[model samples]
Every structure is written in C-alpha cells, then in structure tokens.
Target: MDRVTVSLDELPIRDDLRGQKPYGAPQAPLPVALNVNENTHPVPPEVADDIADAVARALREINRYPDREFLALREGFAQYLGHGLDASQIWAGNGSNEVLQHVLQAFAGPGRSAFGFGPTYSMYPLLTSGVGAEWIGGTRGHAYELSPEDAAEQVERARPDVIFLCAPNNPTGTPLPLDVIEAVYDASHGIVVVDEAYQEFAPRDSPSALTLLGGRPRLAVSRTMSKAFAFAGARVGYLAADPALIDALRLVRLPYHLSALTQAAAGAALQHATTMLRMVDEIVVQRDRMSATLEALGYRPSESWTNFVLFGGVADPAATWRALYDRGVLIRDIGIPGHLRVTAGTEEETTAFLEALAEIGAR
Candidate 1:
C-alpha cells in the first residue's frame, strides 16, 4: 500500500477555522523577553523544592488516574479565595482557558452568541467561533475602557448567551470596575464570565467580580496562578462560581483532565502562596517606574493595574519592536496599530528594556 499525503485545503475543515492560525505570542530567544506578560521571576527556591518533593510523591500514584473531582485542589482554591467559598464552588482545568472553554461549551453552543469589549484577550472570539457561537464585538472608549452604561447597553443590544469581562485585561492592563460588571449582569440574562487572569496584579481596592458571585448564579470569575504565582508552566487556571455552575463544568471536562503531576505542582505552589506572591509589589513598582519612564520618553502608556503596560504614540510599532529585539530586549506588538505591551520583570530586566527603547527613540 502507498501512503498518500493531503493538504488541509483538500480535506474537510470547519468553515470558522479555515484561515485561522494558532493563538499565541511569538516565541523567540533574546536576552530580555518581556513579551507574554509572564511573571519574570522564577519560583522561589524553597517553593520549588517543596513542589519537587510533592511531584516525587505524586509520581507514586502515576499508575492510577488522577482525582477526577480534584477535591483537595478545589479546596485549596476556595481557601485562597476566602469569600465563604467551598470546594463545591470552585472548578479547575489545565488552564483558565480550558475553564472558559467548559463554560462556553455549556452555555454558548451553535446559534447562541457571546460578546466582549474590544481590545481584550485575542482568544475570546476564537473560542466562541470554534464552538459555533456567534461573536459580537462590543465597544470601548477611546482609551479602551468600558463604562457601566456602555456595558449594560451593549449587553442588552447583543442579547448574547455569554459575555466576557477581562479584568486587568490582557495586553491592555486595565481592569473593569465592579459597577460595570454589575450593570452588565443586570442587563443581560445570560452567563457572565469575568476573566480575571491578571487580577493579582490589580490595585488593592480594585473590586473582584468574585464578590458579585453571590445571588448571581449566572456569573463566574476565572483566575489563573500562571501570572502571579509564576506557574505558567504548570498551567493551573480556575473559576469560582455557584456550586450548580461548577457542576455544569464537570459535564464538559474529561475525566482526569488535570494530570496528577499538574495537581501536585499547583497544590504545592498554593501551599506557599504567600511566598509566590512576594514579588507582586516589586513588579507593580517596576510597572509604574517603567510607565513613567516611557511617558517621559514620549510614549503614551495607559495606566496599568497589571504587570505589563500598553503604550501608544509610536511612529512605527514594528520598527520599535525590531530595534528592541536587535538590542537583545523584547516586548510584544499586540497588533493594535501603534501600541506595544511590555511585561514588568526584575529591575535589571526593566532597565535593559527601557535602555533599549530609549536608544531606539533617540535615533
């Protein structure tokens, strides 16, 4: 028998995905990589040791499937959240993206629609389209901020089955105020999935949508340890909603979806959550410093509550990006015309990036 090769165009494929590429940031080697908004610090040595020990213990159970319920891990999230939450109120997946997929799968199938304010996570529309759900792009102000009145009005007009609120929004670094969340909830009769992936970097007084979960069975707040806990490699993301809502997630989640090693690693990280969060203040400090420096150098940076800052007013974003890359520093060009985003790393890393950027601006 002869083996034959085929091209994607010659085979059956979903219409929605015919021309789509995988969603991700560029992966290139450089001396300073602050592109993906990742927490640049490594896991603390003590915490890494503990996690290593935990993984070694979990290896003994490798012969068996992981806990499908992931009860202990859910309990850890509940304890971490501490809004009178319980294990029943939390759901975990490989990452918050998976958790989001579960939600969309449960509520946003064919013919239903989802909505998100523009310039948010690039995945929102892709996820909806992949599920055969219609996607509506809602409006934001010139500054990329959404107001309560605008949110409520848009939700009413779209009549969407699912709505995404990306607080401390990715690539933008601004958070949605609670009133805006509440207003959207009041106007929409569908599920509200607030993506708080960058919540840990938000200001202390910034209200979490988790606080609005009570009595609003249709509301969910997604979170990730990938950013603040420096657990991007572990891929632990979760959501806290009503118990009934959590049960619906189980319907779509495959058995043993989270591997034993992932559970072990994330649980161990949670054990030292405080230590994992120790660098957040420093990151914020560096974020502000970087923003001020950029503004002084003539970049218009949006006020950031997250570890990264999105700045505009560039004559050419690609040229700036290329200049930084050539200088051994790297950041993200989020395809937002003149805007670029940079992650807050250690002071040394911050200095390296700023110096590179300054040099390019000087030329």
Candidate 2:
C-alpha cells in the first residue's frame, strides 16, 4: 500500500484554467463608457414601477423557494420570442453565462471536446475550461467573419461534443448568416449552442436559430435581458431548447439559482415589450450613425450587427486606450494587440468619445 498526503493547494487544478482571470470587470468611472457593450439607455421609469409592483406582490413568497420550474417566466419569454414553445422547453439562470455553463456540463467534458471560432465570445473558451472540456480554437475568415464552410470542415474533423456559435458576435459585432448557422447545425454531431445576446441590435433579417428547433434536438439559443432590455444588473438570462434538453439542465442547476426579485423584475419588463422594441430601434439608429462617424474620422470601423463596433489594425491600441482614458473616455482594450471595442452610448457620450479620439489621434 502507498500513502500520500496532499494539501488544498497541492491538488492539481484543471490545466486549462491555470492562469485565467476570474469574473468581474475593472471598477472605474469615465465621462464616456464605450466599453462592456451595455445598452446606453436607462430602464424606463414605468418599467421600474412595474418591477416594484411585481416585487411587492411577491415579497410574502420570499420565504418559500422560487417556483422551481420558473414556468411563468418561461411562458412569458416564449411568447415574447413569437415562436411558441411549452414552458418545459425553457430554463432560466443567473445569466446567459450560467445557461451556457449548463450546456457545457450536460454535453462536453473529459473525453468530449468543445469548439468555437477564434476571436468569438471570450467566455466560450473560458466556460469550456471551467467545465473540464477541451477547448478547440478554430480559424475565422477575413474581417473576423465566421465561415460556414470552414466550421463545417472543422466539425467533420474535430467532432466536438459541443459547439458555440455567437450570432452578431462580440467585439467584432458581425453576425453569422442564417445559411451558415443552418449548415453548421446540420454538420455538428453534438449540441449547437447559438448565443444571440445581441440579436435585438442586429438587422431584422439576421438569422435566428430558434426557428429550426423542432427537428434539431441538439440546437439551443441563449438570450439575456442584459443588452436590449437594459437589465444588466438584474442578471436574468434564459435558454430555449428542446424540452428534453431543458430537463437535463434542471438536474445540474443549484436551487433557487434566480432570486424572486429578479424573476419579478424580468416578468415586469416583459409587460412593456413594445417600449423595449422602440428603445432598441433608437439604439440601432445611433449605432449606424456612430459607425458613419468613425469612418468620417478616418478610422475604419468593422461593420456591426450589435450595439458596439470593433476597430482593428490600429498602430498602438494600448496607447490609444490610455489616451481615451485620460480624456475621460473608457473604451475596451481587448488586449488583442491592435484591437479596441467601443460600445454605442447616448448621442452626447458618443460625440464626446469621437472628439476625444480625434484629439488623441492628433497627439
């Protein structure tokens, strides 16, 4: 017999997460925040009032566990999607981030592998690691576009057990075409998780994987109230998948993962769906104007389908970021060597950012 002693620090941690930063962004305030891709508009007062009313009505129920099924919220969300699915087809979590984690847990890990395009959502790779799965990084076409042909080829080769496709992808803000998503879904042998966190800002024709859910048992779409609904602090995200897949998620989730207050707030937000759509239209218009402004300023901004734009191939992005910070503008420096992502804020904030950029460029 052999005996060995191991301390808490001595146990071997997962190799993929050896040097990753944990969640939470830097805490700093600036005049213009063109970072983190948050909706610039504040939640309307009427929406807030609705939330308060819902919360007040639910206060007495706080002592009991929240509806374990989250049936009411799911039904409301499914109706909002315009495509009807039973409550059994939906699941809620702390955020779409957690929903993604559940998908990874259910499908990928150990011998199984997860694949996502490079320069896609950074969290995809991070989540793959956190779930003890092999993260396969695939190449993208020019302009950070996700190529369906390339993804199909990789799917045939790597045979990943899980795949993440971010429509209107982060940082670059380019959306993958519908045909491409369909092709990838057909090609994938494992679960195809389509993350549509920014679909509200995307063009109306932008392909949504939700329509193909009937036959594609492996397909799931993750959505959040964070962006278009201006509910970042509420931390509410949901997934629409086949009822069987949703049931699998229920087995792994922690109890009461979503608070009663958050459920009430989300339910209330759904009541003013038309108002939310109007706000999204306004933000889309601002995004287009901002893109034009960037081009007019002699900086090439990537075509965007989301609420932000990515400017690539800059000479010194770190210096540029620092200069913007000094000028009371806070934009994201993606640490991708020469890339920066600027979120669309209000008109005044947008103007300030552009002016600051022009001044910085001259120096």
Candidate 3:
C-alpha cells in the first residue's frame, strides 16, 4: 500500500485563522509584573482556606459528572450581579473567553458580521474571525471614548449580527458613558454583548448594560472571577442575559463546561466578595497614585477606570518597554505602534516601574 500523502495547502482549516497568534500567553518572568492586569495580591489566607474546604467537599462528587445544568452556580452568580435573574437567565463556561465564543457562535457566524471599537480588547476580533464572522472596527473619540453616534451609523450601515463593547475597555482602561452605551444598545438590532471583565475597578457610577436585560433581549453582560476575585487559575466566567439568550448559550456550550472544582471555588469567592471588594479599593487607590506619578514623569496616561493605566505618545514605546523589561518589570506592549499599557501592581512594584521609566527617559 502506498503511504498516505497530504499537502499543507489542501488543509481544511479556515483561511482567516492562518498565522494568528494564540491569546493570553505570557512570555518570560519579571520582578514586577504589570502586564496582564491580574490582581497583584494573592487570595487572602482566609479565602484560600475556604477554597480548600470547598474543594475537599467537592472532591466527594468527583466520581460523578458535574451538575450539567450549573443551576445553583448560575443562581449565585445572578444574585452577585445584583440582577434578579434565575438560572434560566445565566450561563457558565470554562472561562469568560469560552462564554464569549459561544456568543459569537450563536449570533455571528457565516454571513453575519460583528462590530466593536478599535484598540479595545484584542481578543474580540480574533474570536469573531475564529467563528468565521467579519469584525468591524470603529474609531474612538479624543479621549478613547466609543462614539455611539458613529457606532450607530455603522451599525445602521452594516447591520452587524453581533456587537461587543468592553466597558472600562482593556489596554486603554477608559469607561464608556451610560448614554453612549444606551445609544449603541438602541441602535444595535442584533445581539449586544457588554464585556465587563474589569468592572470591579470602575467607579460606582460606571455604566452597566446588565440592568437593561429585561428591556433588551439583545443585551448580555459577560463577567469573570479571574480579575478582582483573584481566580485567574480557576477558569470560571459567566453571562447574564434574557432567559432565551441564556438558553441559546446552553445549546452551544459543551456539557459540564465548568468543572466542579471551579464551580465550588467561584461560589466560595462570591460568598466572600467583601474581601475582594476591599482589595479592589486598595488597588484603585494605588492605580490613581500611579497614574499621577506617570503623568508627573511626562507620560500622558489615559484617564483610567480600571486597575491598569495606558500611556501613549512615547518617542519609542518599544524602547520604553525594553527598558522596563530590563529592570525586571513586565508591562504589556500593545504593539499598536506607539502605545503601552501597565497594570497597577503593589506599591513597591509601582515604584520600581516609575524608577525604570525615569531612567529610560533620561537616556
């Protein structure tokens, strides 16, 4: 029998995914890590104890499959969101990333198009393409604000099947106003997803479309325990929407998408959410101080509502990034040509970053 032969050119892979890099892989270690906007503090000892206890209790059930419906977890999550939604209005997955993919799959595949602002979360476009959907890009206003008027016009033109708006957007860290969010929400005839991964860091007045769930069947809010809850490793994320939309997500999600351990850990985290809120308060204070320090150092940092600060107008952002890296600091180089984003860290880490920036500016 002749050996099987296949040419790489004849592969059945989607053409859009060729040469794309995987998301969220960090390379190298740094003395001060401000790259990924992770909670700089570890889970408190008390919280860790609670997690351990929950894990031990859940271990007894490991022999059996996890609750396929995730009803209990979803109830807890909806209550946590301050939304009076039941299990039918919530869905859980391995991570918010998976939940996000489900949204695209359910709404924006094939001839459909998805829309969002540029320089927002980098993953939105990538995820849209992975689902074989066109991702439309819109420009931001002078202050990195999403122009709802422009967005509305575009939506009218493209009539996108899905729209993703990241409140307190990633990398830029700017929050969209309630009016703008509402305008876009009204303009979008298709599903509108509000990614609130960093909402804990935003001000109390920061706009959330979650409250509009009843009126807008097209609106959904994506949340995660990875950031403020310090559970990045737990890999738990959820969505709150109309029961119909939540049901649609269930249809697309794999069975038992969230593990028993993750469910227990996230539930425990939510139970002790006050501790997380205190940590978030401290981080916000540090973030503000760091922003001031960066501005004092002549860096134009964006007004941030999240734990990270984004600064542009660097003569050479690449050099700035390299300088900080050499000083044992890891900040995200957005590679948007001239901008870099720095996540807020502990006080000492912030000081180290400032010192490195000062030294780099001097040279």
Candidates in order have lDDT scores of 0.91, 0.84, 0.84
lDDT, candidate 2, 130-156, per-residue tens:
888899988787787866787788777
Error of 2 at 93 (Å): 0.9
lDDT for 208 in candidate 1 is 85
Quality of model 3 by C-alpha lDDT:
0.84
Candidate 2 global TM-score: 0.94
Give the winner by TM-score: 1
Question: Per-residue lDDT for 105-168 in model 3, tens only?
Answer: 8988889999888778988998899899998987787777766687677677768898888887
lDDT of 2: 0.84
Q: After superposition, how far is residue 175 of candidate 3 from its true place, in Å?
A: 1.0
lDDT of 1 by residue, 1-363 (tens): 999999887789987778878798888889899999889998889999999999999999899999989899999999998889999999999888899999999999898999999889999998988788999998788888888998899899999999999997876887789999999999999999999998888887777888999999999999999899999988999999999999898888888899999999999999998887778888999999999999999999998889999999988999899899999988999999989999999999999999989888887
lDDT of 3 at 208: 72
